[model samples]
Target chain A: MKAIYKREVQSYFNSMIGWMFTAALTAFIGIYFMAYNLFQGDAYFSTALGATLFVLMVLVPILTMRSMAEERRSRTDQLLLTAPASVTAVVMGKYLAMLTVLACPLAIACLCPLIIHFNGTAFLLSDYASILAFFLLGAAEIAVGLLISALTESQVLSAVGTFGLLLVLYLWDGLVAYLPSTAGGSLAGLLVILALVCFLVNALSSNWKVTAAVFVAGAAAIIGGYIAASDRFAGLLPDMLGRFSLLGAFDSFSVDHVFDVRGILLYLSLIALLVFLTVQVVQKRRWN
Target chain B: MIEVKNLVKRYGNHCAVDHLSFTVEDGQVFGLLGPNGAGKSTTMNIMTGYLAATEGDVLIQGHNILEEPEAARKCVGYLPEIPPLYPDMTVLEYLRFCAELKKLPAERRKEDLDEVLSLTHLNGQAERLIRNLSKGYRQRVGLAQAILGFPPIIILDEPTVGLDPKQVVEIRSLIRHLAKEHTVLLSSHILSEIRAMCDHVLILRKGKVMACDTPEALEEKLSAGGALELSVRGSAEAVRSTVLTVDGITSCEAQQEGDTVKMMISADGDAREALFYAFAQARQPILEMRPKTATLEEVFLDLTDEDDAVAAQAAALLADTPDEAAVQTTDAEQEGTGDESDL
Candidate 1:
């Protein structure tokens, strides 16, 4: 695992991806810092970080597109897979390497809070906390990009797919606002979401019987609960999905200046889930 | 040693490897010979733990590949069909990484790296990037990586596919050298390479094992003493009469062309002297009397070709010999040993 991690990290810097990612991220953060803090005389560094989240949606894919896709394309995965290393080790090694590349810009951005403190009154605790949240947010997004990369052998498709998913995640809060608030509408939306999950389960397991059982059980429970307490179903669909807005959790720190432990747990759990899925993707390819 | 038991790999509707079973004894150079799309690469991939078999298991040194992959993979080093190289790294860097990946002892890695470099003749190319090297050199780098820890089993898939004649000879000798201490399993479609390098050959066709025996045994079984071609300057009837007079000639085929006769005689034993004396006495001057020895090329073509008649004929010849008994007895012994090792 260490060997793979070292090689991946070295290869990122050996190519232009590492430098370009760090430079682009730092430049965006700098531009936002100048406009929000320097010229506007805003004392808070979390505002600049909040503005830089858009840069991450575009550049995190650049850091992660080549992680697993290039290995499959060049057939180098054979060496790693056939070696003594387990698939989990290989995936973790690569994920950690991408996380390390992300840390470079965050490390540079750490200096901005100090500059603000020297200039005037700076909320040092909140600024540092927001930076930590920003790092976790980017780390979670990189894990998502890694999973998408593992699903295909073409780097272009991985990049495009990750960007599309990240754009949806970035706009997740607004998208949930468009959902219907009526009880019947929420129940219909829940059924649709349940069906989509069943389809995904069928695709992964290729077992229709298991998917059908899960779908039937879930739909029955949802309907039974709605009949028992009809008022609980009103405005439930949008509120439940709105809780899944990943960026909304990060905004608790960057915008509201609150250390939300539940949000950090959400980010960490998402990273773990995506990394596990990526490893499963690689393992399933061997059997297929 | 390696054991592949009833291995089957199905790709949706198409089966790439179907009910294949084989064993490689310790210190033997085993060859998987097949034509294109014959599942040679697929089997190698499964054996090396790069892929999983659909309905069977592979055991390397008593460790099941799927159940204990790290233990099984530690005992085998694989050079895949494409070499599996990182072009950006230099030869030295790639080999060192492989050494660490294989978990070679830190103190001995440098010595092992040097030994592998000199063994593969890559000492001079160590500083060069793999992308800058030729295909042959890249292959050598791959071989060097596989040989780094000196694993007991080395599996190479078409190790000499794209090389000059000299490099081909070099790689063949290197494989032979490795076989002195390590069990080597390699795949190739080239019959001559199998005949030249393998102690045991497994012939595959359409994902099925056609024949599994040593090269000499396969040839002997397929063509028991072979046939003989004779050219005599005589009438066709006279030549046929002379050939018929020779004892042990099971079948004689004669063709006539204007005072010259060509005959193909299948004999259970050496009937060359008998035919020569009979032809001389009959005044049929023999121009050519050469015993036709079946080459491995003919055996491979007959076994793998799509023509059912030729395949049936070869199968019939194989049945006439006691080769299947030998195969079965060894298989039973392997099962006994496998059970004991499991305990």
Candidate 2:
């Protein structure tokens, strides 16, 4: 694992991707910090983090585009797979290496709060906490990019696909706001989401019985609940999806001045889930 | 030692390896000889724990490849058809990375890396990026990677495919050198290459083992009904009539090649003496006499009922000493069993 991590880190530094990512991320964050705190005389540095969230949609994919896709394209994954190392070790090693590369810029951003404090009144703890959340958020997105990169051998396609998904995530709240709020519409939306989940479950476990059971149970529950209490279902889905807006969870740290434990857990779990999918994606390639 | 038992690898409905079973002893250059599209690479992949077998198991040094792959892989180093190289890395970094991937101890990694660099003749180009190296150099780097740590078994798939003649010879000699200390299973489509290097050859066609034995034994089997080419200085009609009139002669064909008659003659018994007597009676000078030898193509054809069956049969039309073998029955039996399935 350490061997893979060392190689991945070295590879990042050897090429331009590492420097490009750092330069782009630091420049963007620096510009935002200057404009927001310096010109606007913003008291809270967390506002700069809130502004910088938009930059992650582009920067994270560039940082992670070649992580697994290039290995598959060049057939070097065969070398890694045929080695004595386990798949988990390989995944974690690469993921940690990407995280470390992501860290170089995040490390530079740590000084932003000190700079703001010198210039004016800066809430250091809130600012640092938001930075922590921002870093964890980037970690989660890097994992997502890793999984996306593993799904295809074309680095360009991987980058484009990850960029698309991150864009959707950025526009997540507005996307959910457009959801229909009628009980029937919500019911239909719930059923569609349940059906998609069942599809995923079926694809993964190859067990039709459990998938069918979930679909049946979910249908019965949704219909029964809707029929019993129509008012309770109104506007429920959009509200729930808005709560699930991954970046929306971070709103408390930046906008509400609250350390969101649930948000941190969500980011960590998402990271775990993405890493697991990356492993599955890699294993599936061998089978094919 | 490695044992592959009843290995079957199928892609959906297409079976690449029907049921390949073979064994390599502690020290031997075992060759998997086959044509293109044969299952040699698939079998090698399964044996080295790269591809999982569809219906069988590979045991490397008593460890099952499927169940205990890391343990099994520990005993083997594989060079796939295309050497998996990192183009961005320098040769030195690539070697160092491979050494680390093998979990070679830090204390010994420098020495081991140096050893492989020397063995593969990669010393001069050690610091060059792999992308800039020539194809032959890339192949040698791959060979060095596979031979690292001195694993007990090294499986190379077409190791000499892109090499020049000199590099092929060097790699062959290096493989032979590896055979002294480790088991080697190398696959190739070239008959003479296998015939020259392999201690034992496993001939495969359409995933079936057609024949496996030492080259000498294979030659001796196809050499049973020997045919002789005789160039006699006489009229074609007269020479043919005299050869036909011999008592033990089974069949004969005579053709004139520039004032000399070339007669392909076969007899029911050792008829060289009978033909000589007949020729002596006719007073025709037997200018040149040479026995025809069967190459491996004839051997493969004779076994597989392939395209060369007619040619082999026409060549083998000479009847006489049906059992003029080059070895004893036990020698053939030992060699045949060594190649049969999982010896």
Q: Which candidate number would show the highest DockQ if scored against the true structure?
A: 1
What does DockQ give for each predicted structure?
Answer: 0.80, 0.60
lDDT of 2 by residue, B1-343 (tens): 9998998888988889998888888898999987776789988877877677779888999999879888988888889899999998999999889888988889988888888889899999999999999999999999999998888999999999979999999998988888888888999887677887888988787787776777776766656354678999988999999888878776678898888999777666567888888898999999888765555654544333333443234224222142543212223323222221211
Q: How do all models score by TM-score?
A: 0.92, 0.90
Q: What is the model-wide C-alpha lDDT for candidate 1?
A: 0.89
Note the Cα lDDT for every prediction shown. Answer: 0.89, 0.82
True contacts kept of 2: 0.56
Q: Is the docking of candidate 1 incorrect, acceptable, medium or high quality?
A: high
Which residue window of length 10 is worst by lDDT in model 2 chain A? A279-288
Q: Which docking band does candidate 2 fall into?
A: medium
Isolated chain B TM-score per model: 0.86, 0.85
lDDT of 2 at B218: 71
Candidate 1 structure, TM-score to reference: 0.92
Looking at model 2, how many pairs of residues clash? 0
